[model samples]
Target: MTDFLHLLHHELLLSLVIVCMLILKLADRGRSGSSWSNLLNVLLLINFAGGLLIEAEGSLFDGMFRSNALLHFEKNVLSLGLLLVGLLATPYLRNHKHSAEFHILIASTLLGMFFMLSAGHMLLFYVGLELATIPLAALAAFNLNRGESSEAGAKLILSSAFSSAFLLLGISFVYGTCGSLQFEQIALTVSGNPLQLLAFTLVFTGFAFKLSIVPFHFWTADVYQGAPIPVAAYLSVISKAAVTLVFISVLYSVFGALQATWTPYLLITALLTIITGNLFAMRQDNIKRFLAFSSIAQVGFILTGILGANVDSEGIVLYFLLIYLFSNLAAFGVAGLISAATGKESILDYRGLHASNPRLAWTLTIALFSLAGVPPTAGFFGKLFLLTSGASLGNYLFIGIAALNMVVSMYYYLRIVKAMFMETTAQPIGKIPTGVAPAIALALCIAGILVSGLSGSFYEHIHLLTLSY
Candidate 1:
């Protein structure tokens, strides 16, 4: 009972924070009170701090919500991603009319994501997933007056509903077959049978939709193209990271025994996603659509880590994800910052960005290079570890194909860099005050890429975390 209460307390605390924010919104309605943005920043900081403390307190409640060193690390990593997203959204919201509600929705979504990361049962996982997802569709359409934004929202919701149906059906099948929803119990019941295979495939379909893998990724480009930059960043980083964490947990825990059954499928999916994403990205001139496809390609690289047979694969995946979170956010942060300053979101609008806003251009350049897996950055190390792990598994074909994909990916990623540096601008780009929050966030991302590369300890720590579980 004590343990359960402790676990409950953490969940309740996040819920309380959400409710408090709602009440504050109500009180501020019809009046220009203190800037909700300021309050939100403070509240978000506190929420992040609270999540850390809760993670440190570790798991409570029997095995129902156990938090160990690994999960604690993952929670902190995710919280950092959330914080960065919020900071990036600040300048974006400042210029928009409907800013406050947007921040509130993001906060609420982060609360759900926090729970999703620590979920110990299928029920909790599914609930957390939904809680994290539903708000995002609305956020996608926060620009209510824009037809593109509304269409993006509709698409996201429709696709999300489809995925949720698949997930629920899979859950029902698993429950019917295994007679239990707990990961351990389900794993115990799973055998090489048609029902188990069906359950696995069904669940994988839902997760693949979230991960934006091939065949399940048709909505990504349109949504990215239409949604506001901040919302797109939220989807790219926070939401995707949370889902990936759960996906890893599910793969490593519930389906560890079925590796032989699932590895080939995962391998095939990774290759397909890599090829398709890169091919589509190469032809995109719209920055958001380009990034949408780029993110899909990145997911393929992430899949390589999951396919690793090493004991440290989980930790490696998480560490790489952390690097990805920072690199991708920095890229989007620059885009959002630029978009807010100039009403331009297209790649060509960046003509002579280096001359107009050197700081933003250079920051974006570094971010792009990092994403392309250039050296002395966190992204490079992430790819190195993934490749190393894959090579160790003796999957030469997989490693070789991944290497080729990396080369292909560089072509598209470099296109953005080339546009910023080599191209000439027609007009001087105006600089917006990135503010303390976003500046700090960008700095941290840059620092993370550098620090993670310089320090072997970072990788070692991640290795330990993967092994701990």
Candidate 2:
């Protein structure tokens, strides 16, 4: 009983989501479908709110699972992001018959992320990774009517399978060398032997695939382009953040013993990722694909900080992600809102957008500037902190290379901005209708950006909280 109580946050969220999914599956049919959707939203709201209040204080179940301030913070961030995702999804899902199932699928994926974060053992991490991947493929191809959607889903599943194989092989090697699948046990026993080196490389590759790091990121653009806008939004911010948190967690804790061997690899990967993401993003016309590459570049910066991964750096990592959450989601929300109204997904279609719908134009402008690391916004500070913290560990070369990539990225990020406000077309897209839910979500994201950047106390407080761990 006490053990279960220790996992109150995890258990309650898991149970509530499962029960709601079951209810949606069995009880709701064709009739009163909208009401059922409303109910799902409410239940999800309760689930998110309840997650914040629950006390997940320690390792539970023989230490195979544990909770900490950081994990709880990650969960809370995930919940809030997903809540807004649900709201953004409302307008898009309204017309689809399988809307309820989509919510269930998202809940399922969130469950897997929860497990991934909590897992103290390698087996549980692998289980969580697989659980997160499968449903996401389904969601990628949710629009079965489109050939691109189907193709996206298929590519995702195939990539997921390949990555899982690499992950499992790496685990096998680790187990053979360490004689244990537990993180703490593995950390003590592993060294830079031939087999252990191969294991670490393969495992890092697997994680890189999920984060869509360069060379392993072939599936990113197509999947983003093919998926529905809201699903793309979910994948861009929420899914990637989950993978990043756990990936960094494992690096600092489970594999800290291999730092001498892995640091070079991590730095090289980060540099290449930034270059590839920026160059590719420059060429993308599809908004989703563009953001996909931009996100890849952003990950490189995050990994820059992670190269200097430690207890103190953890706060900076979490802070970078929080501000990133605000900036990225805001951009996606504006894009999603406009696309839903005009059915235009091309960057070329945004000409003279500010002439009518100033809100979207301004929202997008701010978001793009944030992504470009312009001043007075969360992203500028976010990147500043990440670079400085990384350089604090004597990674000046990587920082210089990163500064170059930021310049490359700014050109493309502002390209969309230029199209909307500066350039004019013969027939500009008319004023797009903004839904209430989307409007509220955009407002929330913008406010989050301001508060995160402006409030030094809030910034220090969140950063200091990580020190306690």
Candidate 3:
């Protein structure tokens, strides 16, 4: 137990916190209004800062578990995002019947994500993957009063089952080829063999499902639309961030031996994903579904960094997500506020939003501009760095297609901005009573996006992290 405590410092903190929350829930038993949420929120913020402060970096648990510069950086960034996400989620979760349980589940998911980020072996990765997934289904179905929530949970479970099956098949094949489940063993053993080829193909397909890459992306839009706003936000940012790190780590570290075999494939899939995701997002009326498709489009940009697989590209990818965490969450944060106040979820309902609630309108405007990759905003820098890094390796065609997708994406992202500022409706949602927690969350997101963008030191810090790993 002492060994576990020292080795997985943050994960242990999370585990203990979850237990404490569960006990608190039981103690509160059937209370009309539970204040445990406020306590949990404060505790979680402390955990996030403490997790960031811990500099202990090593491998333990027989080398199956590891924590290094890479893992530490990933955890810290994810913790910061979750800290803000928790703040944003609070307003919506306050009235939940099982609010304490919801926090417990979120902590469990984050614990699993930590495990996944640092898994040294295939079996360890699988364990972490499933742990991260199970709680999301329950969270998606949390609003049991709504039929769409139930349907979203069903779709998520079904897709997760398929992904797991594919992942297991890949694992078994790779194990048979290498006679070991350790990533180092596989890296040393794998070559251009048919078995290695088959294994990586299957494994990447599972990753594609999680990242919502093309062909495996059918479930993304509906799930995002139906789940509770906070759950949708969780899936949008947290799940994607953790999965992005693990997926690239596997491919970049273990299967790098097959780059010639995989690079072209990544490029093709990226092209298709960019085109499909942007096209789909253009037609969406629902706000969450629009961002869902937008997330898919953004993944195409992120994949380019993975395709390059260099220190600079790695830094660029992580930096992009740092700002992306803020930009995307800001948009969702505004959406949550509007939803809470007006109970309106459609883009059309956002018409003339500026007339009454200029704060919400401008907050969302900044977020949308950043997401659209417009100048002086973080999203523009994200795309610029991503394209430059990928293109440096002479990926002109893929870069060209990606640029086109950016143009396509801009049209839809600005659609909401237009609705809020330029258009008007007979029934305009006026003057949402924005609360303190949500207001702070929005400010943090905007600040993150702007500070990261204008500050070259941020890129230097990211470079230092990549060098450490």
Candidate 4:
């Protein structure tokens, strides 16, 4: 029992939060939305704090579940993301009728991600993957009155179903060839044979679907467009971060031997993803769809880091993700505020925004700058390291292509900034009041973006965490 408690403290703490949320639902009658939102915020902060303090390093359930310093750090990263999402969402969720249910789904999906981060076996990973995915479909359709929301949900369901099938087939292949489902055992037995290579391909395809890689990203824009802004932010930051952590781990550990086989494929897909995302984003008028494509392009950069196959790769990726969380959420926070206040979701709707909402315009401008990987922001540092890491692979041409895509990304990202700061509009959006919770969230994101890059402390700390790798 002591071993269980020590090894699984993070999971146990989150489970408690989920239960408490369930009980709260029963007694939620007659409660003000502010009170409910406040309570939820408190719980999320507690979980985030607990993740930082908890310490565990071991395998459990016959290696079905595991934990270590690195995994713990990754979990904390995710916890921080959830907390940020909760804080940013408070403004929109407060007074909404289904706010409680929305939070419950969010918490449930978070629990699933926790399981995913700790899984040591294929079956455990699969279960966690499903847990992490299913609730998001409901979240995508959260706007009950919006037909587009329902369409988003149906599309997500179909996409997730197909991905799961591909993943399961991959797992089955591994089991048949390696005669084991445990990652360590698979690593020991995998020989890069044709069958095993095929298995890895299938699994990679599944992850591709989840990560919104090119050719598998058809659902992303629609889903982001239809989902509530907060939910879209969660899907963009938290969901992508979780899968990215797992993808790096699986590729580095269980399939490390097959690196030679998969690197070429990753290279091709990464290029396609960057180009496709950039071109699509340039054509998008909807802010949600624009960010959705931007996120896809970011994935291509993440792949570049992963291709490094060096010690620094994991830390660089994690650091990039940290920067991305702040940068992307900052943009989304501003968008959410505008959408909630004026129902404007178009790039053109932002024309002359600085005239009335200079603060929001500036905040979004800084965010887009970061996303464009411009200097003087954390995103600049993040992309720099990712490119440097990929250069370790000695593929200058590919790295150059990736670098050029960053320039392409800049044009679209700056287009929004131009609209907000320069373009004139007859009917610009009026000044929108950001409530206390959202204001605080935006402040935090801005601080994180500005400070995290200049300090080097965050990157150093991440390096320390990944030392065990």
Which model scores highest in TM-score? 4
- When 1 and 2 are scored with TM-score, the better candidate is 2
Q: What is the TM-score of each candidate against the true structure?
A: 0.95, 0.97, 0.97, 0.98
Most lDDT-accurate candidate: 4
- Estimate every model's Cα lDDT from 0 to 1: 0.81, 0.85, 0.86, 0.91
Better by TM-score, candidate 4 or 3 = 4
Ranking by lDDT: 4, 3, 2, 1
Please provide, for model 1 over 1-469, each residue's C-alpha lDDT reduced to its tens digit, 9 standing for 90 to 100: 6655455554566677778878877776653322556577677677668766643345544455655667667766776777787787777677466566787788778777767777767887888889898999999988789999999999999999899999889889999889998877888988858887898899999999988999899999999889998899889877888888889879877987888988888889988988899999999988899999999998888888888857877777788888888889999999988887777888888877887678888788888878889997778889888888767778898789899989988998888778878887666466666778788889988888788877889889888767767
Taking the tens digit of each residue's C-alpha lDDT, what string does model 2 give over 1-469? 8657657565567667877678867875764545555667777788788887765577876778888776887888888888788777776776778888888888888888889988999878888888888999999999979999999999999998999899899999999999999988998897789999999999998998899988899999899999998888889898998999898878888888888887888888889999999999999898999999999999999988888776657788788888888888899888887787777899998889888789999999988888899988888888988888778778677799898888888899999999999999888888777877778888888888888888887568778878887
Taking all chains together, the TM-score of candidate 4 against the true structure is 0.98
Of 2 and 4, which scores higher on lDDT?
4
Note each model's CA RMSD in angstroms.
2.0, 1.5, 1.4, 1.0
Q: Tell me how far the alpha carbon of residue 90 in candidate 3 is from the true structure, in angstroms, after superposition.
A: 2.2
Off by over 4 Å in 1: 1-10, 30-34, 54-62
Per-residue C-alpha lDDT of model 3 across residues 116-234, encoded as one tens digit per residue: 99899988899999899999998898888999999999999999989989989998999998899998888999977998899999998999999999988999999999998888888
